[model samples]
Target: MALRVLLVHQSFPSQLIAVLEALERRDDVELAGIGMNPYARRGLRYRQYSPVPVAQTGDIVIDDLASKATLAAAAAAAARALSYDGFVPDVIVAHPGWGEALYLKDLFPRAKLVCYCEYYYLRSGGEVNFDPEFPPAPPEVLHRMRARNAITLASLEDADVCVAPTPWQKSTFPAMLHPKIEVFHEGVEVPPADNRATDRTASGGPSVSFVARHLEPHRGFHTFMRAVPRLLRADPSIQVSVIGSDRGGYGAPPSDGRTWKSVLLEELNGSIDETRVRFLGSVDRRRYLDALRHSDVHVYLTYPFVLSWSALETMGASKAMVVSDTAPVRDYFTDECAAVIDFFDSRALATRILSLLRNAKIRTSLGGHAREAFHDYELTRDHGRAAWERLVTSF
Candidate 1:
């Protein structure tokens, strides 16, 4: 009999898409999914579930917990129906961050449960209060943050195995559960060099680039924006491309209902020339990779939390970088591969960006090292393939 597998997530397979595709290529495996985005991957039977409404609402903290509980109950009902219909999976994999996987084991007692353990909340020593500019989060907000992780903690009780994308992320979980968790990144395909060409700079000057899912404080957009004027002061001929949506993803939303982008732009008014800066709002994969190829210097800054895939892709593409020296980056980035800087220091950031652009020899040398580092840690590379395969079999 084929190996029957089921994948679950609140939305699309945020980090599981590659795993889904890999499993689909095997004739010995059968695949299915339960999520909000059924079309994210092909060759899988999918069932969609929506959040059950909470009738009573009071404190934001209480309401949030009730909502997650409702989602878990609703999803459990759906899974029970699937079992009744004769789709009994041998193994179940889920990203249980949103509480949807809370009762899966109860519904399928025989199936081994493997969870994608993304991040565990901490009062300090994590992303919570990393930025000093934002006043300490209120007591109620902190309570809600811990409450949010209740489902993740609960789901771990029965998980046969758990996967974390990075070592730093895995460390955030309680020490007792460390034995059950393994570190594995969802790999990226490196496009052939000849397939894409670098974009030509208008003035023949070096170009710097930044890419993120959203221009939010958690990823250090404010720090990047603050460094721009000083960067232009040092190298007026250089151009910059900022790629991402103007919305908050990890951090709190903007107070005035304006995007972090808009607030930063307003603060930068009349100081730096807008002509030198181009805001390429959230491009597709092809364009994003092209941006990495064309960039002379790439800047990535983030808090002490889950690392972004773009950072790894930039390294894979062999782009010179000035990266923030934070916990998430310390695992894969170092002085040898890129210029490491403090997340809060705008002056130091500008100085490093200027230096990299001015020296082509150093840029190429560091970029070569960056690409080498990618192959060293990247799952898509040959060296990591066997380990990734072993991980799947273990699950």
Candidate 2:
């Protein structure tokens, strides 16, 4: 018998890509999806399912009264639309953080719900890592934030199973919910490393690359720019290639008023030569992978992040990384296996980079270990397939 499965998520391509790929391997499974079009760019919709329509509403509003009402109403409306279409999935897999799962239990009473639980807030300091630059909110504001998260918790009660990617994430939920949670890493294809040697003199000099969506304040881009001056001072042969564009614009603009990139450029103007830093705005996938292949070191600094796809990609490509010593990362790889550092300590980060650049043996060893770790934890396609198979079988 063919199993009918429906996956729901706001960010479809990102979280669902691995699961979709895994499901594709099965001959007897039917997979469909419902997701929001956050960006305006249109492409081929989900392979099997019709796309679910969504309004551009403020689902993340901080205010208590407005936030609760907005989420409740949206959930009710979404449930009604899906139910009216006569799309009753045997098994439903959803990412519940966006409040989409609020009324899912009521709508699909017979279906078993499986949730992708990303994070649960705790009283600890790491919860504020998303907005690290700002000081901690007042007690009342914190209470309100906790109250907001209650809706997320309520949604979980409807879930028959909950998938969490990291141990830290699994630990965040209450003890009662632990039995229902399963640790599942989103696996990716481990591409063979492009070991093709390049002439250092040809591309100006030995270059390191940072690839991400933007060089924003939150991503520690400015800190990296600051470290560039010191790094260049020590070794003039080293160059930095930043491969990404600003939020709303492409290419370099002349003296824009106080953008994060502009500020960094100004700060490092005199200390580091302009030629040493190259900001190649966003490039295609081939170019991005090529940059990773050619890079000597990849620096990934985040305040407190769950596993970043970019970081994992770099690891899969066998690039040595210097990542922040956050809970999510530490839960995955130890210091001996991968380079880890304090998030706020720029000096420590710079020192790690310098060490990796200087020691080829260390770099090679770390890269090898990173690749092994990736294969063990990240590239296990069969495991993901098995998880999906189990979900379908239960259905």
lDDT of each: 0.82, 0.68
For each candidate, how many residue pairs have backbone atoms clashing (under 3 Å)? 0, 0
Please give, for residues 159-183, the per-residue lDDT of candidate 2 as tens digits.
9988887777888778899999988
- Candidate with top lDDT is 1
Candidate 1 segments whose C-alpha is farther than 4 A from its true place: 40-42, 192-200, 381-389
lDDT of 1 by residue, 1-395 (tens): 78778888887666777667667777887887888654645667777777767777678899888988988987787677677777788888888888888999988888999889899998988998889898898998899989988878999888999988889999999999999998878776764432122334767667899988999989889899999998778776788889998865888888889899888888888665778888899899888877777788899999998898888878887778999999999999999989999999988999999888877777777888887888888646333344444666564
lDDT for residue 40 in candidate 2, whole number 0-100:
25
Q: Cα RMSD to native, each candidate?
A: 2.3, 5.0
Clashing pairs for model 1 are none
Give the Cα error of residue 20 in candidate 2, in Å: 1.7
